[model samples]
Target: MAKKKFIVSALAGILVLGGIGVAAPRHAAAEPVSGGEITYGTQTDPVNWNPHQNNQANAFLYLRNIFDTLLEKTENGDFVPSLAESYSVSDDGTVYTFRLRDGVTFHDGEKLDAAAVKLNLDKANETPYSIYAFPNYDSATVVDDRTVEVRLKKPDASFLDSIAYIGWGIISPKSLTEHLNDLPSGGQNLAGTGPFRISSYQKGAQVVLESFDDYNWAPETKAHQGKAYLDKVTYRFLAEPSSRVGALPAQVDVIEGISALDVSKFKDRDGFVYLSNDANGDTFKLSLNAFLSPLDDVRVRQALRDGFDLDALVKSLYRGEIRRAWSHTSPVSPFYDKSLEGAWGNNVENANKLLDEAGWTERDSEGFRVKDGKRLSVRVLYPTQLDREQRSTLLQGISQQLKQNIGLEFIVDLTPSSTYLKEVASGAVHIYPSTWLHSDVRKSLNGLSNGGALATDNKADPSIQPLKDLAAEALATSDNAQRIKIFHELQRKAVIDDVTYIPLLVQAYQIAASNKVNGLGFINQIGSPEGVYDVWVAK
Candidate 1:
């Protein structure tokens, strides 16, 4: 592989500048010293380590250490060179050509080339189960030993941002062929050209990683290159928040999911540092299953939205730690429509009027709204992984409010993470609670559109076709301003008019790390850790 330089086009500049979210990195005041180990405490363990196989956001926390994305995104949303030293896009904005950097080899000793990049794209296209799968992808061809060409079925401005994500990371073709079936179990089945390699994986317990000594490729935006400073990194699964917080600086060098209520524990504490940043992603929301009974009526959906006070509920639960979200994307997103603020909220009178207009005026013996002898009840499909205390409290409040304000009975159906997806896709539940981990608003909108991951049975429903069309248009538009305008229209259609999704809270990363761990960085868009490549232990 040989490195080649090329001038980026106007579309390329728009794509790079389109990344709006910025991340806050933690830098230690002391000088960096190498040769140490750092242990991290995380809430959930990834079931799969395969970059193309797994779509879990938690998986990226570790998978990023084992694989490298072709292009790296910066804190300010600029896509820089990494595995691909330089890239250029076609004038039509459908073809992308990447020039591979020379002297890079996977941990398994396989050399990286144009064919390897093509294979990864082909694998991604075939695997529809992954969120990173390119629905618009047509084909990938190897131009030369160091050049690869990717062709999309349509023009997609978000394509570069999508590839820069961890899910699109390049894995060794040999490893993918050998452990294709067992890649989900992880363990020793993974190999990549990242700063570190997975030495071992203990299911339900921990994952151990050792620095890749031969690694020299890093994004131009990264301050550190070559080998990672730390010799070893260990990630221990601590499902319980108390257990994770208990470990602290004594047992683990770093811990994630620290509650805002417990921020005092690490702030200004000896040998500990509290790190917090607003995540640049989709907000936690409830997707109303439009295919279901009464929900099929737009009036009923608007009534449900008007029944609850999301602002007060989020404030009460998060205690100002998290901000109330009115739209799908975070408020920090450059494309977020600020006009949506205060557009929809608690209105018992309006809720009653809407429900009455929908012919749900009669109340049953249990005081639940009844239409044509059927009670108005919503079955909420909740995932077990998100069954935290705060979420539980939020649901309780919603249930109480809907019951009192709108006469709608809220039935919670707690489902395990494994079966949750299947259950939600079955459309048996009236409401599905989830969030998208994408930094791009176009990707988030696509997931909510017809035939998307969150669309489920709503694919055939005509109501969401408008949203789907808007999402497609946004993806095709190369100009940032035009894309932003399209997003604004899409938001009004989905949140205000259709009321398909009810926004709740914007999630932020609350991490507590030992002062000894220095140079902690995050993925520019989602605020996820960008591995320990730059992190060094202070002497």
Candidate 2:
């Protein structure tokens, strides 16, 4: 019954996941005790504090408590009001009206109003970080003190969904002028309207967030009216999965997901409990970075993508726990296009022809192709913390496929967590793999799949321009039926024509905590660690 999906109404402004509302549970209903600091162990440290720029799935471990979105999305894809009291869209769908809560305030003394919404929306649309936020947005108009009328260039049905899920919760009007783009790690210097305040941060080590005493505007679904029970929430970055699991029951109160190999052992452990949910987002993908040379050549990117085997890797490493992804969007998403089931397959003959046609006709004594004095060599880089057998074997297979069949040298490089992003962003690495944790179908329009100058997958390929336009078309058209057509058109281009982004497998986030921890659950946004405000010490 939970799997059934009904057609979404284009004019409807509300989101109802599984046809029900997830009432934000209260502390009194949960195990009751005064308070205790929750030390959370995470896989990696966030590089940026700016929500628009921070793409890591674990970034929410800190930011969720510090910020609140305008609306909440249930795990089943329903939308509920959050920061904004209620919202509605015009018949044409170009204008959206959101009514603000009566007395909401940022951590700073600034008041929350329509002006704050407009300022943040305007800033997000301009920044490269806000790739999916206000995607087709034109301008924001403050209708009144509590009302905001957002005007879009075209009609869009999912614009509210984008707002309901942006990591950049409306910032303090004060912080906009002061902390704009200068925010450091954990966003300790930034101000938000959530139930927690960033108290301290030690850069790559840990971030401490103290509860906001004056916070009472928690969404109506929330069980508590004001002030969180826990006094402090500390997120400690432990890159090693084993290190995080070891910290349990003592050093840390909760640990984010265990290795697949260790899942059974932790399942029945008396002092601990396991929690997991299948993510409705992008799975692990070997981003075919076309910006780098050799790979900058579209045929080479397509050849490499076609030659590798992703199903074998998923079957070998995941053991049926996760399935190989076909489209850039998750299978769980409504926009996912399944016709591309076998669009990319093992094709050594096609791979060889592509290289030969690209004028890599000369072979060195080592049997490697060379054109214009440059060897057909590519480097693969991945974070050390992400080095699981599944990833390790996948890289090895990618290397073997390119080297043995086509004489392309695939050098595998291990990058430390601290400098991984810098190395990937330096444009030196040809192949890098990561996961996208967005619930919105617009995941294809951001980062690697964006296919723009800022996107890693772009390499002056004029073909991607049309797909980008199609993304805007799909986003702006209010009709879900029309969107399905446009979305498939974009997926067809991405999979068969471009082959720039390779979707590997669907994955889940496992949140585990001490048995004493209570009221930890999903938030209405993407990523892990949901509503921390409801969590409290058990008596």
Candidate 3:
């Protein structure tokens, strides 16, 4: 499980009120003047806001403030009850019983009970592409109006962490029934039992949310319980980074996806602060199409892994803001093993030796390696965005370096965001840049090992048996210490064994805020932005 650390004291003393310094107000006693609108900017436009349909982080951040989950993570990285006041796991770790809180109502004014909870879980399980599908759940039983029990097929220690994911947010039973047929596709209606409710939404444009005054079951980590301090939250779509950053100084209260180059520009500004951290959120990596002709050979894959340099790529492109990753697990991930340093730096001699052993000595007049009338080349595909452009340029540079030293030809193929996933899923591309959204290594590794067509590049199947076994063992063990040990071992095997994916960088979570904004804090886990319920702006 990924641990979430909170810095309460870090933001307790920092006061920013309307471009002037103010004394830190007393905790819980200082009632903020509620009834102001906060404008936030994001790079990507959300496809859907409904929890049952959308899985993007930006969409979740908006939905989390409106929909409550059965449980939530604290600053100290512990699981606490949210909709359910308390919960207990069976001795075998397969059965979970939740004791629901009383007097809770959904934004739609429907009562939230055990039946609602069961209905929501059942709907989530039935969804074909849901995150819940990965857990192999059996069924949810309604013990009574305020109590429910969930049974899993196997003992999964990471069940709580998985629940902390964005796709696991609980929805109202009424909404599920109304949109039952559209559940598999996408639903436009937004219904949740969270602190805020959707007042209005414009597809591919903006979403407006109003605080729910009747909300009272806030977790202990929450600073305010009755109502959110802000009257409304307006999330606007700004796909370009330059425009988003420019909007910050113009009084945009909050924004996300700030580039590293702009961090120092706003660091010392008064009344302005940015919350940044190396959360175990996403891992950026390169996926190799093992099913391709030349790549089908293990020695060829090993040679490709040994031929590239990651440190230079990080320094030149990421400006040292992100950490270089050796395994699929990020530094903050519980599964990360410091001992395994993976294939790093340039090793032309070893790469040549591996290729030679694989019987690829023949070379064409152009000086590219050839085997059985086929040229040794690969086409790398990536999203045509600024961040992706930087990564692609770095890959091109690495490929040029490898060609000069080891006689391999590489091509770059940039694709639009809309068609990237479909292209990858159809196996139309070979090399591509991809990311694993979940914090747990098991979930990330399982996607690659399951033999299903990847969202990008379905042409090759990379055998992930080693990773699958590791995930199974980690989830089966009940002991926390033992689970960590097994996870660490799994990461080691992933790095040293030269798996299908090469972990490259761990990008830090960056958010740009205005001088008037307050109450924003760091959540050192996946889907950190969901804690926006605690955020407020001075009136």
Candidate 4:
């Protein structure tokens, strides 16, 4: 199968704002023999097939198949047209006008027009689910049957970034109006203009998707775009890592959540195709709760930031599978600041000086720092999973190092995901490891210190206001050059100066498919697999 490249052109996108018509997408006709099924295995079941209400990684595995975003994000981070033929932004950047493509239909046989776009956006904005990260979008107004005008409160240059976001994909206006703010259950209400529609879904079991015969609108980033080649695609929820890896070449055509050992085992092998992409949403970091006693002091937080050998942490946890990373965004993000590397990187001697200067001078018999009858110890709450042993091993090394250098005691408390939120909300646990997955890095950076963890996280700190102001200015401006500057400066100030959060490494999402599968692809900024839409088995 050849690569599918059916997106609207950038030059045409520019010309579109000036009232020039954009060219049609180049579709690749599939071979006459199109009837086949793609059965794949994933780690988790879709929380809900609805994207607006869900934010899990595996959820997209289902949502993406049933829905299509207005634009398609490429591997290189460019946004091209999908549901929308071409869209143009107002000069002030507050208004976004989209020209709908002709002949596109949703799963329910409803035509995707300006009304559909308005309905989906309006519904998504009102969903009570807390994880939804669409920008502060105001409204979507229908200019004409084929055109829609979306207005934002302010200029968000990253607005185009989330256009291809999961759940932000346009839905059928009729289905939404019928449901009217009440979420339909068990994926029953799922409707989109994607190439496939939900055939059958049993919660926590299997989801079957059949290709939409009338489906034709696909962003140019895909390969062979008339409709998905496979007649049906079955996504089986295989939770165990061993089961996921074992079924790879035979039982399942594609599998994810493969263990690190299996990734190496199949990397050079001929029968398996391993695909790894960096996730943009979150970073693996020890969030220093600024409200915590010792961490409340900026000097102490800076000391801890300087003390930890982050490269060691990365090596221990990921075992060389991923690299040490900096910044709130992935390296591939447009606003990513590459210069932030090693600028706030780990150190040992500087850490001791800061701690000593902060008046934690007394050392106890156990060689741990003591001040005012308090031990220099911190508790870190983390989820107990496959990496618990690895994290324990790394913490042991850190314990030895911190004890010897700064006389600090580091305690790691493993918790389950069920109780994880309870512990975090309790505010008793200040330090913990968590990932923040998102599409736009601008949103990521601004809210990085505002919520969750902070070393000395005072949102109203006059000391940190300049950095926050710079970020606020960065978000308002649509200029990439200015964004790059502001993002870099924000990284330097927050991580290095404020010691807010230490970005250990960029998270890697692994997808392994059997040799039989072809044209498995990815979308969104984080690079998760788009769907089995373009995949076909060689029969």
Candidate 5:
């Protein structure tokens, strides 16, 4: 269930992890010790445990530590062997062969084998909510106990990049039938081959992971190739910034995505380390439901895009901490189109003219545009947990600006993650805001074009078929140059020609860790924090 971001809320909750938050006795620094425990404060709990069925960034961020994919992507965008010791693709690119690592075992003690690989791939294809769909994926065959072959219906150049996603994370085959629905609760059913195992899960409160003592297989790129140094990692769900930062070196050893205001507190602090990275993924943007009245018209959509002053709104909300985005892809990505930067801006007069031309010239007593006795109003659907930063304030400002500038009413609808998914699927929302995860350009197009995950859940109009075809062409070819060209045209059609989305701002990941916490690194090129594999307390 790929979902949207959050809305405004008050900060009133705090977590109490027993025996955590107590400072250990300090000593002189020496070699990295192997047995220690640390508590991590993160934002959201996993909504679903089935990797293929959930696309929430927070869920994958945590699961990356619990599961191992066939291959691991390096920080420099190179692939290295993880579960699969080696892999090769055929010349035509329709077939792939993987040699599973020897002596590897899932947490449940099931030996890693070719049969497990085939079972995972086949199950992903059968799941409806799987975000990474290999339309060309045909079938998988077990060549031997440690060898497997995957045949595709057609050539897909992006297959390797797509398979590296944690959503394809291999699990014990028996759990598929035994504990399919309850994986979210995470006990013995949450079986993965990674360095950590779920010791316990406390729903929305916390999840405790203990190091797998027998784990030794690590990606070739990593220097450490043994069990996780930390004995235990307790992830406390702290959605509020005040509670997370307040825990600090006392209650939590690491806190994720601290507010920009909290960065100043760590700069001069002696025992803290603050790390920041320019995230590589989808920009925070809004998708308009074309099935709805007024929004179905291109003129109305264009008016909405140019109606608000995004530059001013971003400055006021982020306060120079984050950058404004003008395209669908992040500026950090090679596929980003610099030409779209100045192609559009805040043009109040032009927005008004466009709305007038769309037959919304009449104004009601509330100053909202009216046509056929109906006022022009849109409801923006957003989740509730994302208020950790200033996201709520940012959205409210945009709504107010639209009302003042174009005589259009923008209503902010804040709901829980469960309700948000249902509203998005019902095709009843007028506007949906989201920021998704994508390491490849084709994945970005999946959310922008018709029938994409981020696109409105409605029947695709015949006119948008060409846009969808461009997305398919980008994925079918492996040539980097040809793929780049296709992505440019696809973005132009979606943003400039069709007015499908309003590009917002680039996402920045900020994390703070105690000086005692060592060997902290990101999981992928997109830079989500790796689970406590190599991290150790320096004492």
Candidate 6:
């Protein structure tokens, strides 16, 4: 899932109406009341709403309003307490103790306690679909009625950062006891102890969230206290980007994601402003399944890596707004290394030499290299959409370059998003474009390099082991300075040696909003429209 940027402009003073000090009314006849409606659109409908499932980040963003986590990342990149009032970690970092806040209740009116926290963490560990099911989490113990202790298998410095993930959202123990099975698989019974409560949810259409009147344990980091300013927030699903952009100018108050191509359309619109930021997300990349035949050869893989011009591709496809990446860690991220830029660009001579050394000495009638009676060919699968079309064109150009320079054959397969994930996971597709939304290198590499069922087999390439080890060491150590050093080394290795996933470009998130909308801010890491919480309609 791509992180949506939060864009907010400063306001001078609060609006007044009818001799009362209230925020300015955005629409006519509507007083600046606390209970009103705000409509927004999303490009894709989430597959599941269960925060435990690692399906999509956008779902978790919507879930964030409903669910509470132990910690949350503030705009300034600091981790503050959300549910827990204070926390202490062991010197060795194996144990984490949290003191739960008092006077908090879930939507169902259940008291939030340490036992409830244990239940939530236990459920996340036992659920098969959970992204945090690794052996790292040893156990969760209730130290007291309001205190919980978490034990880890190793001293992970990023453990608190991991807890900040949406997958670790706190749930009511009562809700879990009643709907254990439904809870993990994403049923309608969504409940949490956040600022808002889910009034109603339609599977693929929309979700209605109403403020929790009794809620008071909001994090100190949040600007609004007690009940949310808006009475109800309606998340309407609109998959078409153009349609999403169209709704914002008329009836919709705020829309989440605005692509680079759509940014120009809202530059001078009445009462509107554009909020953009260099996203902590990267463009989709071509993931080569190294286990597949022909690609399994190191020489062939290196040739493929050396044959493409990433800079030119980004310039042509993205209108030069994006920065070309040389490593999996995005440029805006903390782990980014500027010295590794363009580590793998077009080198036609090196590509041909690598192919020749790999025993592809003979060219077939179609000008494709062949060995052992098999042609050097593979299909590059991509999703069928306008944004995907741009990616496909880049792939097609790289394929042509490979064929002309090193006598390799390639084909393109365009499919729907659903079919694409299924095909890629099943190993049916040889090469495909995929993306990762990770602010920290540990989280980014864990999604791709962790040696588990979810680990990409591309790591089997010996050249990738050092990079994987660096990520592992970073995850195991508790020292922040040491972890940073290891992650930087991992970034260099990913670009200079591994060459596993081709880093393409860092995409800029574009948001065009009406001028009436104030307090719109940009959050580069997590891309959800809910960042609109700070935004309000101008009086």
Indicate which candidate wins on TM-score: 1
> What TM-score should be assigned to candidate 3?
0.85
Query: How high is the CA lDDT of each candidate model?
Result: 0.78, 0.69, 0.65, 0.68, 0.75, 0.63
**Candidate 6 on 96-172: residue-level lDDT in tens?**
78888898888888999999999888888884657666457899999899999888897654565556666788877
- Arrange candidates by lDDT, highest first: which order? 1, 5, 2, 4, 3, 6
Candidate 4 all-Cα RMSD: 6.0
lDDT of 6: 0.63
Q: Each model's TM-score?
A: 0.94, 0.82, 0.85, 0.84, 0.91, 0.84
Regions of model 1 farther than 4 Å from truth: 1-18, 451-455
lDDT for 534 (candidate 6): 40
**1-539 per-residue lDDT for model 3 (tens digits):** 22122222111111100011111121121345566778888666565555656655545567668777787665445666778787766656677788889999987788999999888888777756354554558899999899898888976655665555556778777777786555333233557788888777666677778888888888765776777877788888787767778888674777777766676666677756766655564367777666665666767766777777767767876676667777666666655667757445467689899899998899999898888888888777777642432466667877887787778887877777667767777765666766655554456546444332232344233455555666666556545566667756655554445446667777456666775677765443463454466676665
How does model 6 score by TM-score?
0.84
Better by TM-score, candidate 5 or 4: 5
Model 1 clash count equals: 0
Sort by TM-score, best first: 1, 5, 3, 4, 6, 2
Which scores higher on lDDT, 4 or 5?
Answer: 5
lDDT (10s digit) by residue, model 2, range 1-539? 01112222222322221112222222123445657778988776676777666666667656677888777666445656777877776656566777888888889878999999888888777756564455568998999999887788876545655676646567787777777766645455588898998898887788888999888877654656788989998888887778887888689988775767666656678767777655556667767665667877888877777776667766776666557778766666666788989867678789889989998989888888999988999777787766643576677777876777888988888888778778766666777776767665556554423552224534446756666677666565545677777877776666667665777767566677888887776553453557588788786
- Which run of 10 residues does model 5 get worst, by summed lDDT? 10-19
Instruction: For candidate 1, give the lDDT of residue 60.
Output: 76
Q: Which stretches of candidate 2 lie over 4 Å from their true place?
A: 1-34, 128-135, 186-188, 220-225, 289-302, 347-374, 381-393, 413-429, 432-434, 445-466
- Model 1: clashing residue pairs? none
**Worst-scoring 10-residue span by lDDT in model 6:** 13-22
Model 4, 1-539: lDDT tens per residue? Answer: 12122345542221111111111111122343467887889877755556776666656767787888887665545568887888777666677788879898878878888888887877777746424555668999999998888888986656666676775767777667775344435454667888888888877678888998987777776776788888998888887778878887688788766656567867767777777766666565667677668777878878876777778766766776677778655665555667777677467788888898999999899999889988998887776542321445565666666777678888877776558767777667768766655566555666553533543335566655666677667667545566667767766665777666767667666778776667665554565665777777766
Look at candidate 2 and give me any clashing residue pairs. Answer: 15-78, 15-79, 16-78, 16-79, 17-78, 24-221, 155-476
Q: Which candidate is the best by lDDT?
A: 1
